[model samples]
Structure formats: C-alpha cells, structure tokens
Target chain A: MLELIVISTLNGVLFGMLLFLLSSGLTVIFSMMGVLNFAHASFYMLGAFFGFQLTKWIGFWPALVLAPLLVGAIGMAVERYGLRNTHKHGHVAELLLTFGLAFAIEEIVSMIWGKSPLDYRVPALLDFPAFTIFSTNYPAYKIFMLAISVVIFVALLLVLKRTRVGLIVQAALTHPHMVGHLGHNVGRVFMVVFGVGSALAGLAGVIAGPALVTQSDMAASLGPILFVVIVFGGLGSLPGAFIASLVIGLVQTFAVALDGSLASAFGPLDPSTGPSVLTDIWNVTIAQVAPIVPYMLLVLILIVRPMGLMGTRES
Target chain B: MRKLTLAIAVIAPMLGHAASAEDTIKIGYIDPLSGGGASVGEGGLKTFQYLADELNAKGGILGHKIEIVPLDNKTNPQESLVQAQKAIDAGVHYITQGNGSSVGAALSDFVTKNNTRNPGKEVLYFNYAAVDPSLTNEKCSYWHFRWDASSDIKMEALTNYMKDTASIKKVYLINQDYSFGQSVRTDARKMLGAKRPDIQIVGDELHPLLKVTDFSPYIAKIKASGADSVVTGNWGQDFALLLKAAADAGLKVNWYTYYAGGAGGPTAIKQTGLDQQVFQITEGFANSGNKAAMDYEKAFRAKVNLSLWYPRAVNEMRMFKAAAEKANSIDPVKVAAALEDLKFEVLDGGTGIMRKDDHQFLQPIYISSFGKLTESEPFDEESTGWGWHLVSRIDTPQAMVSTTCKMTRP
Candidate 1:
C-alpha cells in the first residue's frame, strides 16, 4: 500500500511538472495579451517535430535547444504579423485567429510528418532506470524531465522577479499605456513575452516528444488539459496555473492508481438483476473515470467559483 | 459539424460521374485523409490505387477501367456517412472504407439504408481493416462485405496460441474504451477462460479511446500487477504511447495486439527494443515468403514511399475483381452476390474465403513478432531495421469462428 502511494505520488509529480511546462506559457500569454492563444499547444507540437527532425541530424542535446528557438521565432512572427493585425478587431477576433492558426498548423504538421507518431527515442544516456522501488524501475528519462522542468520553472521565476526585462514585462502587463508614456517599446515587450511563452511551450514539447507519443494530434490531445489547468488554477495567474497543473496531474494520476471501485464502496450489487444507470456506475472502477475528473472539475469550478481558485478576473 | 461540411465539400468534385465512350468502374475510397488517422488512410489509399493499376494492367475488369475515387472522411463517422452519400450520388457502384470501426459501422448502416431506399442505386461496401466483430455479426448488412478478419476470430487465434505457449501465465488486458475495445476485452476473457483455465488475468484497464497522451500511470499499474503478457486492441497513438511507456519503464512483457502492425506501430516496437517480445495477429506481414507479393510490395513501396501495411487491401481488390468477373457485370447487386462465399488466393501466399452468412473474410491469420531482419525476411515497416517474423500461422479452418449474422437479402 505504501509503495503504491509512493510510486503514484512520484508519477503524479512528474506528470504535474509536464502540465506546468505546457500551461505556464498559456497562462502568461493570456495574462499579458488578454487573449487566449489557442495555438499555444500547436507551438509545442512544432517544437516536438522540429526536435525529432533535428535530433536525426544533430543529436538530442542540440535539438533540445534549437527546436524551441525555431518554434519561438515562429510564435513571434505569428504574434507580430498575425495577432497584431487582428488586434484592432478586438479580443474575439484575436481568439478566432489563433484558433484558426491552430488548425492550420496541425494540417501543415500532418502534411510534413504524415500524421503518425514519430520515432523520438530517449537518448541512450538517459534510457536506464533512475531508481528501483518495490521491483519497479523508475526511468531516468522521467527524472531528467522532472529536473529540466524544475530548472525552467526556477529560471522563469528568477527572470521575472529579479531582472530588468522581467520588470519591463511586468509593467507592460498591467500598464501598457503608462509604460509607453515612459518611452518604452511596449509593443516590443508584448512580442518578446509572446515569444518567450511560445519558447517555453516549445521546450516542453521538445522534452515531451520522447516522453509521450509525438504525433500530429499531440497538440490537440494536450491543449484542452492545459486550458483546464489555467482555468482551474485561475486564468492569468502564473502561480495559480502552476498549482492547478500539479493538482490536476496528481488528481488524474492518483485516480488511475487507486483501485477503488464503486462496488467496493457500495457493496453487493448484482448487475444481472436488470439494466440501470446505478448498475452501470457500480461496475465502473475509479480508474475508468479518471480522465473525466478534469472536465468535471472544470464544470464545477465554472458553477461554484467562476474566477477559479487564484484568479483575479471574473472570467 | 464543420468537419462534416468540409468532407462533403471535398467529396463534391468526385460526385460528378460523366459517362464516356470507355466505361470506367468507380470505387470511392473513404477514410481519414487529414487527421490523426491520415497515415493509415494514406497507406490504404495508395494500396487501393496500386491495386487498381495492377488490375488495369491485366486488362480492366469486364473491359471497364477501374478508377478509385479518393475521398477524405477525417476519421469521423458523420463525415464518413456524408462521404458515402456523395460517393453514391456520384454513381460509384463500389465504395471501400477501413480505419475506424465507428466509421465502418456508420457506413455499413448508411449503405444498407441507401440500398433499401433505392435498390437500383445500390453500392457495395468493402471493409478492408475495421475488425469490430459486430460489423460482421449483430450489425452485419448485405450491402457491406468485410475483407478483413473480425476481432473475435483474431482473438480466438491469439488465445489458442496462448493456451499452447507454456511461457504465458499471468495476463493483463488493456484497451481503448469503445465498442471495438469492449468487444476485444470480452472476447479475450471468454476465449482465454475456455482455452487456458490455468492462465490468470491479472489486470484489465481501459482508457478513453484516442485520448490518452501519457500512459505512464497505466504502465505503472501493469507493472504492479506483475503480468507476464498483455492483450490489447489499441491502435494509433494509444498503441504507440502504451508501448512507449512500457519501454521507458523497462517493463518486459509480451504484447499481443490486433493493430500493432498499424501506422506508428513499427516505430514504437523499435523504440521499445523489444526485439521479438511484441506480438501481432494479422492476415499477413510484409516479410512472409511470397515472391509475387514481395515484388508487388517493392514496386508499390518504391512508388508511394510507404510500407505495405495492409495486405488485406490487396486481397479486397483481387476478390472484388474476381467477383466482378464472376458476375460478368458492373452492377453492385451482382458483384455482392458473387462476393458471397468467394474464395481467392491472398497476396502473401494464403487462401481466403468470404463467409456467405456474415460477408466476413476468413483468412489465414498469422501471429508474428518484431525482430531483426533475417535472410528470409526482405521488408520492414517505416524502414525500421526490425521486421515481423512469423511466429505461428493459424490456417483458415482453425482461425474461422462461427458468426451470428442474419443477413437480409436485397
């Protein structure tokens, strides 16, 4: 029982860290732009694909660094040329534009990558087990993922809190007009923030490509979960997004790990008696419904806490 | 809704069939062309087109040219129904689809309803890969003819192999949560129990179909359960991700899969470094010693830049041509009638027969494993060094399972 809990907790933390890597960029971008970049996850996919192709020629380490830079450049171009033009049309237009870009990017990726999962293997150096607990070999690649995520998180916090670029970025978020009046390039700051956010997403994807299945729909699969994290953590709140990512990751992971079934809880329900929704529910194990927990939490939050746990905005 | 509309729009051009001096046989190819299922669909389309060329090279069926009208359904059932309608409207006498069973089931019902409503404008449905047994059993239709082995038949062969293999003891079941996955789980349980009473089922896990991005949690559970082997009917990304998780955690166990030879499967198996641990049950593998089939595969692969993933597509086309010749007509009704109880030599050196009662093809199903290329093996999927080696081949008589289909004749 203790081993199960221990293993489940570690796995949950690893998953939570990945969710944070994806959602952090989204939350930051939303906070600064006041527009949800639905294409954020697609940028991550670009990173993964770029990384896979790059890894083929230049090895894993270089691809890890270069893929995100390329994706960030692409993200910056989208912000400057695509999002900037649609800005005059209001937030809805920006949202719609990003949404359209997401689809376009996915189609483009499919054309290039052929819609199947790529063969993005972990480097041989990190393929061995990190540690073994209760006869289970925890992979070194996962520990590497956890370590890199932690470093990125710390680096992001440090850059935001203790640096001049960070202060300028902070000012631009709350007071773009004031910052412009003070003779700063507020537009450039917004562009830079967008680029960095996208770069972060790309980095996550580069690492996650080998960690998960890197396919054309990889973005579509993780996009909704990132939204759930941001919304549940309170949209536009970086710390909220962080907490929410971990919470969701743990909730889903632990839910799947736990062997609690409805029948175990209720006791003695014969499915053969007749057909009933209760019977259906009775036969379902907790793990079967783990995927639905995030969506359920989303609905519950919308009903009870519209702004989310740490959200500053009503939405 | 947009997907459905887009599918119709894409299919609109192919709907206009102009009668010319040289009569042509139009076969509408409907499957995903733009989404996650596109790779598999693209391979299927290429195989169909290649077969059409092969058929045309040997003089067209009944002296009518074979033209495969390719349509993209985007892997959606509603979109598939729309595409099917467009195909029928375009005067296509034969339409084939095989990727998702949901899409297959929808097309089956739609074709049945369309044929019933308008007997003269009937279209014969040829399913080349959707293995859901219900497509041949409870939901079997006279308009639909599946050219691939059903899930139950494949599972029966798989379990029979398991029963004889002394190494397999504790087993686990993991699959996508859907009609097909549920059917696989049920069939595996029933067959395994009946065949090997000593085998203990350690764990059974089902995740939402095509939705799981991370399978570490599932793999952790599998490891904890200490199962020696896994039975899964998962395909596409689900199959890839599950195997990846196992690979990462170094969970060494035999995986018996239905679609492990599907689109991203070879890559996953290679990444896992499982060599011969991963097993798949299918109609044919690329390396199975058939010189004619191998030569054709080589030519097709050279032209299309894809491995020959579906030998059944070749079988389906050959059978269709034979049936068309037998009936001596391009009429859909006659071809389907002739297709019933039809027997033909498969591409990879085997005989397959269409069961008249179910319209399901009963072919020699082979249990193969991924391993290094040997002297006899000539091909591999996706250029992966590893090719599928034939572990066991259950001939048609042994692989055949009784069907409960009650077909209503048109």
Candidate 2:
C-alpha cells in the first residue's frame, strides 16, 4: 500500500511539473495580455515535431537549443500578425482567433510531418535508469524532465523578483497605467512575456514528446486537460496553478494507484442477494474510475473553495 | 534554341498519345491523407500507387493505362462523402477506401444511393479495413467488396483462443468507447457466454478514443477485479500507451488485443518488454510469407519512403489489382463482378477468395508470439527483433468461419 502511494505520488509530481511548465507560460500571458492563448498547446506540438526533425538532422542537444527557439519565433509571428489584429475585438475575439490558429496549426502539422506518431526516442545520454523505487526502475529521461521543469520554475521566480525586465513586466501586469507613465514599453513587455510563455510550452513539448507520444493530435489531447488545470488553479495565479496542477495530477495518479471497487467500500453485497443494479455493477475496478477524479475535484473545488488555493479571486 | 524546339516537337505527339491512353480507365483511391488515420491511409495509397505503376509498366490493363485519382478524406465521414463525390465527378469507375468502419458505412451508403441514381455508372467500392459485420451482413451492397474480417469473426477467433486457455477464469473487457469497441465488446460477451460460461466477466471499461493519457486506473481496476486476463480491441497509439502503462503498473496477466499486431505491434512489444507474453491475435497481412506480401511491402516502402506496417492497406491494394485483372477491363460493373468471383492466391500465401455470398474476402489469419531476436543470416536486415518472430499460422479454415449469404455469382 505504501509502495503504491509512493510510486503514484512520484509519478504525479513528475507529471505535475510538466503541466506547470506548460501552464506557467499560459498563466503569465493571461495575466499580462488578459487573452487566453488557445494555441499554446499547438506550439508545444510544434516543439515536439520540430525537436524530432532537429534531433534526426543534428542531434538531441542541438534540437534542445533550436526547437523551442523556432516555436518562440512562430509564437511571436502569431502575436504580431494574428493576435494583435484581433486584440481590438475584445477577449472573446482573441480567444476565437487563437482557436482558429490551433485548428490551422494542427492541419499544417499534419501536412508537413504526416499524421503519425514520430519515433522520437529519448537521447542516449539520458536513456539509463535514474533510480529504483519499490523495485521498479524509473528512467533517467523522466528525472531530466522533472529537473528542467524545476529549474525553469525557479528561474522564472528569480526573474520576476530580481531582474529589471521582469520587474517592469510585473509592474505592467499589476499596474499597467503606472508602468506606461514610467516610460516602459508595455507592448514590448507583453510580446516578450507571450514569447517566453510560448517558448516554455515548446520546451515542455520537446521534453515530454519522447516520453509521451509525439503526434499531430498530441496538442489537442492535452489542451482540454491544461484548461481544466488553469481554471482549477485560478485565472492568473501561478502558485494556484502550480497547486491545482499537482492536485489534479495526484488525484488521477493516486486514483489509478489505489486498487478497490466502490462496492468494497460499502461492504461486500452478494450479487445474487442484492438488487439487479448492484449485481450488474459487481467487480467494478478503481482504474476504471480514475479519469473521473479531475472532474470530481473541479466540481468539489468550485463548490468549497471558489477562489482555489493561493488564488486571489474567483474565476 | 533549335534543339529546344525539336525537343518540344518530339514530345508533343508523345504527350497527345499519352493523354489519349490516360482517358480510357480511371480508378479512384480515396483514403485519409491528413488526419489521425493518415499513417494507414497513406500506406494504402502507396500500395495502390505501386499496383498502378506495376499494372502500367506491364503494358497497362487491357491496352489502357490505369489513371488513379487520389483523394484525401482526412478521416472525416463527411469529408469522405465529398471526396467520393469528387472521384465520381472525375469519372473514376472504381473507388476503394474504408479506413475506419464509420467512414466505410457512410461511404457505402453514399455509393449505394449513387448507384440507384445512376444505374449505368455504378462505382465499385472496395473496403480495405472497416471490420464492422453490418457492412457484409445487414448492409451488404452489390457494389461493395469487404476485404477484411468483421469484428464478430475476429471475436470468435479471440474467444475460441480464450476458451482453449481455460486458465483464464476472470476477464476484464476494455476498449475505446466507439462503434468498433461496442461491436467487439458485444460480440465478445456473446461468444464468451456461449463458449466458456464458467469464465466470469469481472469488469468492462470504455475510454474515449485518443483521449486516455494515463491508464494506471484502468489497470488497477483490472487487478482488483482479479481478472486472469484482459481483452481489448484498441488500435494505434492508444493500445500501445495502455499496454505500456498496464505493464509498468505490474498488471501481469494475459492481454488479448485484436488490432495490436499490425502497425503498433512493434512499439507495444518494445514499450512493455512483453517478448515472452503469449497469445496475441494480429490481423492477416505481412506475417504470411508470400510473394504479394513481400513485393507489396518492398514496393510500398520504396515509393512512400516509410515502413509498410499496416498490412490490411497492402492487402486492399492487392485485392484491387486481382479484381482489375479478373475483370480484364476497368469497367466498374465488370470489376465488381470480378471481385465477387475472385479466388486468386494473395501475396500473404492466403487464398484471398471473395465469396459471392457476401463479398467478404476469406483471407488467412496468423496467430504469432513475441520470440527472442536471433542474429540469423539470410533474413532481411530491415526485418529484425521480435517483429520477425515466427508462430503457427492459423490457415483460412481455422481463422474464419463460413458465412451465410446467398447472392448471385458473377
């Protein structure tokens, strides 16, 4: 039982960190621009596909440097041409534009790379087992993913707290009028933040691509789940996002880890003796019920703590 | 300048002659080229290309070079109809596709309706990989030729295997929550109930297609249910992901996957390290050592610059070629008639005999296992690992049961 919990918790943390790498950028962009970038996950998909191509051409190290840079440039272009034009039409318009961008990007990805999961293998350097927990060897690639995510998170925090551009960005996020009066280029700040956020998503994609499956539809699959995380965390709170990401991740991981039927909790009702419904529902498994954990958590959180943990305001 | 003018003068008559020859027989290749099903569809298209090239190289079919009009369905049923209509408009006599069962059902209905509208220009539909039994059984059309086994037939084989292995007492049924999954689950339940009444169905879980990321919960449920075996009919990345997650969670039990042995077989094997795992029922394709299978794979890989893993697509192309040859002409009606009467040996060493009763090809199925990779010489270098493992080939008689359709033969 302890072993299961330990393994599940570790897996949850690893996955939560990945979600944070994606959500952090999204939250920052949302905080600054007040426009939810629906195409964020698409950039992540681009990162994975681009990384795969780069790795094949040059190597993993070069791919690690170049893929996110390419995605960042693409993100900048989308912002400059697509999102900026739609910004005048309110947040809804911006959201709709991003949604269209997502659709177009997915089609473009399919066209260029084809609609198949790329055989994206983890680099040979990080191919060995990191460590054994409960007699199961966890791969070094997962550990690398966890490390990169943590480093990014810390670096982001330091930049926000200590750096000049970060300070101006923070000021713009909180007091836009004051930052403008101070003669700071708030538009440039917004663009830079969006670019960084998008690059972060791309980085996550590059790291997670091989671990997960790298395909055209990978972004679409993750998009909704990421939305759920951001919403559950609160609209613009990074800490809240972090907590919610971990909570959602753990809920799912732990749900899968724990093995028991709902019937077992209420005592073993004999199928032949019990009602037809009870009999029909006999031998139901916990894994079967795992996917419902996040939705259940979302509902419970909305009801009990509308603001969410560490969140400033209700969504 | 004189040489250029002379070159154009020489090419002009040849181009005119080529254009005249191309106007004879037009065939449509409808498959998903840009969506989730592109890998399989693209492969099918490549095989079609190979057959077209081969046929044209061999002095064309009946003194007319075959012109294949390719259309991308993008894996959408609605899009498939448009593509089918486009093919029809482009004067394609014969059309072949049906990557997904839903797509096939939609296309089949459209073709049937079109045939009624234009009785003279009826297009022949050759389905490659839509395994819904309704296509051949309830929805059997005169213009349609199903080239793969139905879900019911596949489940029969699977349940029979389970019944033979009496050690599998409690079973958990899980599949993608869609038409294909529902069909497999229903048929499997009926077959299991009829054959092995003693085997208890502990759990039945349905996950949405391409949505499930973590399968640990499902694995836990299977473990808690005390299921001695797990049965699924999931295809592509979903199957590979689920199997890997299950294996990682130490849900060590017999897992019988219907579509796991095709394109995603090697990935699943490598992911789970299930080299010693027994009893997997893969669809018939490249496993059967025959000229058609080898030649199709070689040609397809060369043309597409990708591996030929999806065997059903390859078989579909081979079936199309056979039908065209049998007809001795590219006329839709003639080809349809020929397909209904086809009893030629396919590249897979299986006798691909399309029954006049239902138009379902009675192809051979192989039951293989993941064996130790050997450094054996003379084997193709491209073919290595457990993917090249040998197991007993379940001949056509053992693989498929007889169908009961009383239709007029060609």
- Best of the candidates, lDDT: 1
Q: List per-candidate RMSD values in Å.
A: 6.2, 5.3
- Per-candidate TM-score against the hidden true structure: 0.95, 0.83
Reference-based lDDT, each prediction: 0.87, 0.74
Q: Looking at model 2, give its docking quality level.
A: acceptable
Q: Once model 1 is optimally superposed onto the true structure by TM-score, how far is the C-alpha of residue A303 displaced, in angstroms?
A: 2.6
* Tens-digit lDDT track of model 2 for A1-315: 666667777878876877787787787778667878999899899989989999999999889989998888888878878777887788899999989989999989988987766667778898767886655556777789888878887787788778987789878877988999999877777777888888888888888887777888888888888877877898777777888888887888776655577676776776459567665365455655667677777778788888766667664
Q: Write the per-residue lDDT of candidate 1 for residues A17-90, one digit (tens) a residue.
A: 88898887888788777879999999999999999999999999999999999998998999899888998899
The residue-level lDDT of candidate 2 at A270 comes to 65
lDDT of 2 by residue, B102-218 (tens): 888898889888988897888888787788888887777777887777777777767766778768899888888778887888888888999999999997777767767766546
> What are the DockQ scores of the candidates, in order?
0.61, 0.28
lDDT (0-100) at residue A258 of candidate 2? 54
Report the CA-based lDDT of candidate 1 relative to the real structure.
0.87
Model 2 alpha-carbon miss at residue B213, Å = 1.7
